[model samples]
Target: MMQHCNKMLHHYIQQSHSNVTIKEIIPGKLQGRIASPTSKSYAQRALAAALLVPESAHPAGWSELRRMGLCNDTSAALDAIQRLGASVRYGDNRDTYYIEGGFLRQAPAELHIGESGLSARLFTPIAAQSPTPITITGHGSILRRPVAASMVAPLRRLGATVTDGANGCLPLTVSGPLRGGTVEVDGSLSSQFITGLLMASPLSEAETRLLVRQPRSLPYLAMTLEVLRTFGIEVTHAPDYTEFVIPGRQQYRPTVCSIEGDWSGASCLLVGGAIASELRGAGIIVENLNPRSLQADRAIITALERAGAILASSGHLWTVGRPATLRSFEFDATDCPDLFPALVALAAFCSGTTVLRGTNRLTHKESDRAATLATEFAKLGVEIDLSTPDTMAIRGISTSDGSLTVRDPRLDSHNDHRIAMATAVAALRADRPVTITHAEAVEKSYPHFWDDLDTLYTA
Candidate 1:
């Protein structure tokens, strides 16, 4: 059998050359059942944890992960672990991964994380656990994002030597055997590096105390802690998530972990269902989601409820039904910024105006998400006002017939995954077909997005 890592790399190369043109959506034409993609967020974290497992914990030294998401981000995580001295094998089905966990006896010269932001941040600290000098770098939009304050400074405070590229961007060279102690990190930007610290601290020589300032995305921290627990590592944090306490000199227990479905990708399908389902037609059914998942994007259910989309659940399966009309709703996305693109697409089909808060969290994503959302949505005839730095007000154009009048225009994804998915969902109500450039951007987190969307069309 071909190695899963090589297969994933091949998929990435193929996706780089693909594009998609979404035709006009016919009302009552979309109805189907599809499983949500595995959560890349969880999969990547789990992969990182797997690398720290000592051979003594599991005689086989292998951590078996089932139902792992093979998206580009997760692929980067897998590749990083292998380069760092782990062995990976996939089941015939390709969804089960057996990773022999232990760092390589020799350090790699450099770690290339592709365009995954999470990989760069999460692995930087994990990489710092080693004493050798290693350079962490990425390509495309990630090279343009600022990581100095969020990643570099925190590592420095923890006793690691980090050198950043121009403008505090990627190509970061770091050397460390990170010393553990009380350190303050600005959490206003992202929760990813904080997670990295939490994962790395246990291996340090002394206990670690994290003083987090203005922490955002608290749910992700919870998820990180949960992943740590699964790997037999312990972390304690305050109720408000302002501080974290990790005992050092701890070793990871290699074990099996199952990745959960991705709500971030499923949100688009649910919104598409709400827009395409007729009054009496059966809506879309998305399976494999856990209602109690700590993943932040699960808040998509709240937005759908506020928009008056018909929702029902039966165990792991949730179905979205059509409402007589989608009502404009307000949502605070400060803690769940990934939902912004899907929420924007939903807002374009709701009557009146929909206000979404937390535009401030959008600047450093795969694209400048706030500006990208505004620019692309405008081509589809939706007006998004970003006059306020922290808020986005969307003026929707739904008619009395519950249909949207959108133009047939060319859109660009800015090589951002969420932006590509958002535009495709918004195009469902267009009067004419919409062509999206860099449509393959969805491969970052949901490689099967277009295929899944097609299933609904053909159903």
Candidate 2:
């Protein structure tokens, strides 16, 4: 299985060099079940925590991780950890990772995070724990996003010396024996750096007190806290997540854990199921998702419910089908901004106008998500209004007759994974085939996305 997974990863890497054109869907209902991909969100946090564990705590100081994600972002996290001096090896199944933590003894001169924004932010503070100077860099869209306020400022306040690349972005040279104390962090841009701080603070000689302002994506913070707990680290926080108190000089216990299934990736599949389900039949069943996950994107269920999509769940299985009539629904996605792309696709098939708030959070993502979604979906005749600063109003193309005509069959993914999946899902109900450039962007979070979409048709 490990060899198979590696081959699959190699296959996607090769496909990324060319375009993947999705053929038009004929009049047919989607069927079959696909397991949700492992949650990279959980996997990354776990991997970072594993790097801090003492070898004395467990045999050879190894932390076992199961159900690891096969996405580029998680891959970046793995690579970042290895560069920082932790040893990693895969089990026979390739689904389990045995990480021997000991990064403090030796620090790499450079850490490249690839295109993962989360890795760039989550590793900055973690990397700052080293007394030696370490340069953090990445490729693709991540280099273009601003990080000064979210990452550099806070690390500097904690006694880390940080040099910005050019315009306060990546390629940051950071050095520190990070001291724990009271520090203020602006949380409006992202919560990833805050997670980094929480994980790294335990190594400081003094206790850490974080004063976070304008915190967004609180659910993701909860997820970080949960991972910290699993590794036997303690963190106390304010009820509203405005402040956090972490004890210093704490040790991370090596433990075996399993990552949850990702709702972020499953969202596109669920939207596809809601859009393509027959009037009377079993809809698409997505297995392995936790209904009560702390991940912010779990709000997809609420949006589906608001849109009047039929949903039923038993244990880890969720089935989504189109209702007798789909209605445009209002959603506030400030905390779960990643859901915007999938929700946009779901709204495209609903009647009337759907208003989604949290446009302010979309600017620093893999792409300018709000602008990209509007631009690409318009090619399918979907009307999206972005004139309002904090809101996006999408006027749905009435699919009363079961299909909508694609205004232009060609589109672009803007090298963003969510955008790629969203466009592919929207095309399921299109009158014509849609061909998307840079479609391989799905490898970022969901490496098997195209394959899973195919299962719906072939089944």
TM-score list, all predictions? 0.93, 0.94
lDDT tens readout by residue for model 1, 429-455 = 676656677767888899998778767
TM-score of 2: 0.94
Model 2, 98-139: lDDT tens per residue?
Answer: 999987657899999998888888888988988999999998
Which candidate's TM-score is highest? Answer: 2
C-alpha lDDT values of all predictions: 0.84, 0.86
How much does candidate 1 score in TM-score? Answer: 0.93
Clashing pairs in 2: none
Judged by whole-model lDDT over C-alpha atoms, candidate 2 comes out at 0.86
Native-to-model Cα distance after best TM-score fit, residue 17 in candidate 2, in Å: 7.7
Off by over 4 Å in 2: 1-28
